[model samples]
Target: MRLFIRLLLIPGIVGWLLGGCSEKIDPKPATYSQLLTGTDKKSWKIVSYQVLDNGNASSVIPAQSGLDACIADDILTFYADAEHKLEVSQNAIICYPNEPDIYVTDTWTLFNANASLEFYLPVLNGKFPWTIKNLTATVLTIEYYFPDINASYRFTFNSTTTK
Candidate 1:
């Protein structure tokens, strides 16, 4: 009886260990260029941008400290053709009715192999690299490395609420 019991237990344990080995993991990324720039062309807002240095969290800029009215109504729009735009609005108190709003158009791309984002700002001379932490229809999270500051900046975004 002991011998038979030992035989059954050995087979069961071996089968359990080898069961998952044959199954392969899919290498394709869940988030792609098509997903980032959806068909509807929805706009996204900067919900928050936090900087993590040595495991400490902090806001990137002074405006991010508080939802100052000056940069309150900022919106980002991304298109499928690798073009994006940032629309910035100033506080109504400071902005005159005839004052022109700020609109910045730039080129952006995603390297699917490494799951990183590259922004080619016309204003800037070089490309900015950002590793995508998470991406979805409603939210987008990215990490950027600032060599000068030696800190990793993470930016979180949420879909804008359209009127």
Candidate 2:
């Protein structure tokens, strides 16, 4: 009697928990066109930047921006100006790491490498924490958190033709 009732309850509870856990959460990336168009441009700003390892401990490179966009090959040139303590430095660096293992693909991968970290460009009057994921063209979704503070910006790129 009691054993039979316990068995029934156990199955019901287990099913309920599993069902709740099955919901998928997908976060998308913003598109290159959208970025160029400045559709959601207000969400970000070019604040004082730093080039550091993913651990946020070691400083690989300092701040100074003079990046030339090469949409043809998806490259950004980090020209070494006087601010960067150089004058005739003009070279293009791959936006992401060259290695497939370090670079993120179709999945959400996190790296703990010496020089791999997600950078956040500051936003004027921005006061929220957010995340970007599921990078697609049709959808750009952003979510916010407590005190309505947590906010996320999604970005996606179409072409690799940066030149």
Stretches > 4 Å off in candidate 2:
31-89, 92-163
Residue 82 lDDT in model 2?
24
**What are the per-residue Cα lDDT tens digits for candidate 2 across 1-163?**
7897789988899999999988688886543333322332112212122222332423221123322231112211111122211011112434434443213111111222321213222221132333333323332222222343332223222322121
Q: Name the 10 consecutive residues with the lowest summed lDDT in model 2.
A: 82-91
* Candidate 1 residue runs with Cα over 4 Å from true position: 1-31, 59-68, 82-102, 120-127, 161-163
TM-scores for every predicted model: 0.58, 0.22
Question: How well does candidate 2 score on lDDT at residue 38?
Answer: 30
Q: How many collisions per candidate?
A: 0, 27
